[model samples]
Target: RLSNVLKRFARRHPDVALTLRTATSAEVSDLIRRGEATIGLRYDRDRSRDLDCEVLFAEPLGVVCAPDHPLAGRRVGKLADLRDERWIAFPEVPGRREITASHVFALFLTHGLGEVAWTPVDSLTAQKRLVEAGLGIALLSQSNAAEELGSSRIATIRVGDLAASHEVVAVTRHGGFLSAASRRLLDILRADFTKARGTNASRRNGVRRA
Candidate 1:
């Protein structure tokens, strides 16, 4: 989503050197903490104490399944309603934060559903493929599954009590110096998110971030 904005920034600042790296949120936070990167953007709340975080947006998440699945198109009112359903799990990388998995488990625990069943898949694409094959449902960000939902390839199963979401944030070392270019990029990101929030509020009666 920020691809266009990044391209524009590069074009506008031809003399400035920019390097983009994609990694897990934990790894990104570590890079910034160690002075390897000036700034980082990621999903989920940062647990690192050495960085400052600015939440840019909140993305709603939902249970998703193949269009032909039994629970497809259904709004689950309780987590218990899904206790018997099989799930496609995202493998938790050791020593790293697994926000989605943790959130899903927490929701289950809240409703007294103990140790739900799942088949683990490490890759997001593979997980989606498994869901497409009607293997199992998976929890996913609505935005990430928008295309599939629109095409009827998959459907979001809304759990009334499951208000699952993640905050997208820009992070920087708490006590570190931010180069002028990094500050400028961060400013552009904040401005872009502000504009998005206003546009969303007008169209949806709420800001993009909940």
Candidate 2:
């Protein structure tokens, strides 16, 4: 979504130089607080006084697996069938602030199937690659796996009782200077990010429904 916003932002201000930085959710906050980056986008909101957070959108996370995986195109209704599948995800610790790790298991624990087989991989790229290789399945947002999902290389595995999403928020240093370019980019984000993410979600859901 930010990429799309940047495309337009760039067109409007060709003189501006835009550099994007990537990091974990926790790292993003730290970067903003230390003035390493003028604008930061991260999952979930932070409560500290060093930054101001505004939610851009929620990216829905669901069961994603290889196209040929047994559960790829099925509507899963029970926890029993999912208990034994190999899960590739971030290790989840209850009551912790995690961007991508916790969504995969909360539903399992809620349904009384606390024991699950999972491998922890810190990188989202590695997790997706593992799932695509048929090594394991993962709980992931569509945006994170857009390329794979769009090309039919990966597919969504829907659980009847599952609902999980992480909010993508725009973060900036509190009482910090905002450049015209920065403010304009933020304006683009504020104006169009939801529609962009919403369209992506609809397209993915349509594919799943079909």
Candidate 3:
């Protein structure tokens, strides 16, 4: 999504010298805090006092499975319904370190779930591939996997009693000024996010009705 936003910005400001840096979420926050980067994008629900953040969008984050999984086409009534199921999880522990924090694990704890059975992987694509191979169910951002869900290669498992979700935030140093170029880029990003959010909401509603 950041790539999409940058493409538009580059087309309009062809002469602007733009540098793109990719890093772990912790590193991105640090870059903004130290004034190394004017803006950064991160996905998480946590708030930081050292930076100002504009929420791009927040949507239900849920489980997903391969099309052949027994629960693929089913809507679960509670988290406990799948407590014994295996998961594809991140290779980190929540609250141990900011860089290693796992929002998925935090969600599990929030639901009073005990230690879960999982296979850890650091790559999102790899995790999804594992799910496609029927290794285990994985946590997924509904909007991120729209294409797969639409094609029926993957199915979202919505828990009726769970309200877990995360937000994508545009962040910059607190009380800092954004250059005219950065401000223009942010405006474009916000507009694009609004359009995407509406589309995602419609898709979610349609799936529920089916």
Candidate 4:
């Protein structure tokens, strides 16, 4: 979803240099606070007064798994049924911020399934790949793995207790200057998300492999 907005940004501002560094939401906020980056996009809101945060949109989260998995096209009646399944998620640890795996892992614990099996993977692409390889299932946004879902390379399972969503927020240093190029990119991002908010809903309303 963000790639399309960036493609447009690149075409319109060919002279602008775009460097992307991916990290957890807190790390992204820290990068901006220390001036390592001018603008950052991340999941969830940052409470720090040091940065200006704008929520771009909220994305629905769901389980992702291999296409041929037993739960691929089926509805999960109870969360306990997944206790024996290996999950590709983050292991709860200190200073762990919820954005990727932590949020997914918390879902299980919230339901009293604290001992659920999970594999820690930091990269989003790698999580999807591992799911495809049948290593484990993952909780992810539909748009995050749109291509795989569209191609039937992965599938989504309807877990009644796992209905959740996370916000995509844009952050920048609170009292810092934004270059013309940076402002332009922000404008494009906002406009792109506004236009896409509706269609993206329909496209991912009933999908996933987890």
Candidate 5:
């Protein structure tokens, strides 16, 4: 979504030359720290001290599985219930892996379920394919799971007691100054996401429908 906003901004301001790089939140932060990129859009939790960040929006993460999976019809499940299930998880490179690992570890320590086994996959598309094949279950952002969940290609299982959320953020070097074009591009991105978030909030609150 942030990428799309940037694309539109570049089109609207053709005089601005934009170079964009998309990667995991961690990688984006690294690039900013190394001065490879002037500005970035990344998850708030993944931001580094090397950059200044502004919160854009918060999004929830949900559990996803094949339509025929045993947990498909379940409205919610406890984290411990997934102990024996085959899990499809993000690779080591993904920032979410660290967050997921911490959650898993905490759950295990509290419930004594021991360590759960999982397959590390790098791409969301591949992970979704694996879930649809009934090979395993996964954790995914609601935005990413929207199409599949709506089409019934996959089922969403809520984690009742778990608070899983991610925030999208805009970041730039702490003391670095942005060029006029870059600043204008940033303004466009902020406005675009602000509008999108308002729409999503309204829909979620039942004030409007998608």
Candidate 6:
């Protein structure tokens, strides 16, 4: 998605040229801080003292289970209700997983749910597959759940009153100057997400209406 945004920017501003490099959120932040990459797209909490950040969107998180799981048809309820389910989660070493696990743990702590049994997986796709196999439940961004939900391969249960979310943001070095190309790329990304956010909001609202 970030690369696509950059490509759109290059197309719009033909005179500008940028070398885009992709990395994990932490790697991107490190590259920007070390003056390697001019700008980065990462989660808001990953922002460091050496970087300045502009939040693009706040993405709601959801709990997913196999279609026939007991939680599938339940009304949105407390986060505690999820404590007993087997959980497929990302390994702790990845930057994204660190952020996600922290939030999940916070929810457990906040609700006095204690520790939950979770199995570490390599990627979101793997986690999804595990959930689809009825091996465990998993937490996912709504975007990642779209295809499965549409196919009835998985079902999502909202965590009532536990509205966990993550912010997507654009980051640059705190005092660094942006080249014309970098600035143009940032503009394109901001516009792309703004349009996407609106479209997604509309689609979700439409589904609710149905």
TM-score of each: 0.80, 0.86, 0.75, 0.79, 0.75, 0.76
Cα RMSD of all models vs. native, in order, equals 3.4, 3.6, 4.1, 4.3, 3.7, 3.8
What are the runs in model 2 whose C-alpha is more than 4 Å off?
92-101, 196-210
> What tens digits encode model 1's per-residue C-alpha lDDT throughout 1-210?
588669878988889988889887778888888899898887766866888999987766789998887778888788788888888876677645444455567789987788778887777778788899898889887666777878888877778777766778899999889878788888889888777667755665743554
Assess each prediction's global lDDT (C-alpha) against the native.
0.79, 0.81, 0.77, 0.81, 0.75, 0.77
User: Across residues 28-63, which tens digit of lDDT does each residue of candidate 3 receive?
Assistant: 788898899998877753367888888898756778
Ten-residue stretch with the least lDDT total in model 3 = 93-102
Candidate number achieving the greatest TM-score relative to the actual structure = 2
State the weakest 10-residue window (summed lDDT) of model 5. 93-102
lDDT of 6 by residue, 1-210 (tens): 555776677678888656767666777788988998888777665635778989888777888899998779566668877788878876677555234555667778888778888888767788899999999988787777888999999998777767777788788899899877677677777888897778768876884323
Q: Can you tell me which runs of candidate 3 are displaced by over 4 Å?
A: 1-3, 34-36, 45-49, 93-102, 105-113, 146-153, 175-177, 195-210
Position 203, candidate 3: lDDT: 77
Model 4 spans with C-alpha error above 4 angstroms: 78-80, 93-102, 109-115, 200-210
- Give the per-residue Cα lDDT of candidate 1 at 208: 52
Per-residue lDDT for 115 in model 2?
61
lDDT of 4 by residue, 1-210 (tens): 778888999999999889889787778988999999998988778888888999888778778889989899688976777878988865555544544456755677888876677788867788889999988988887677789999988998888766687888899999999999999999998987776676667666764333
Model 1: how far residue 69 lies from native, Å: 1.4
The TM-score obtained by model 4 is 0.79
* 1-210: candidate 5 lDDT, tens digit per residue: 655876788788887677777777777778888889988877665545668988777776777899998779586557777877777776554455232444544555676668777887768788899999999988777778888998999997766666566788887888988888778877887887788789877976889754
Candidate 3, TM-score vs. the true structure? 0.75
Q: After superposition on all CA atoms, how large is the RMSD of candidate 3?
A: 4.1
- RMSD score of candidate 1 (Å): 3.4
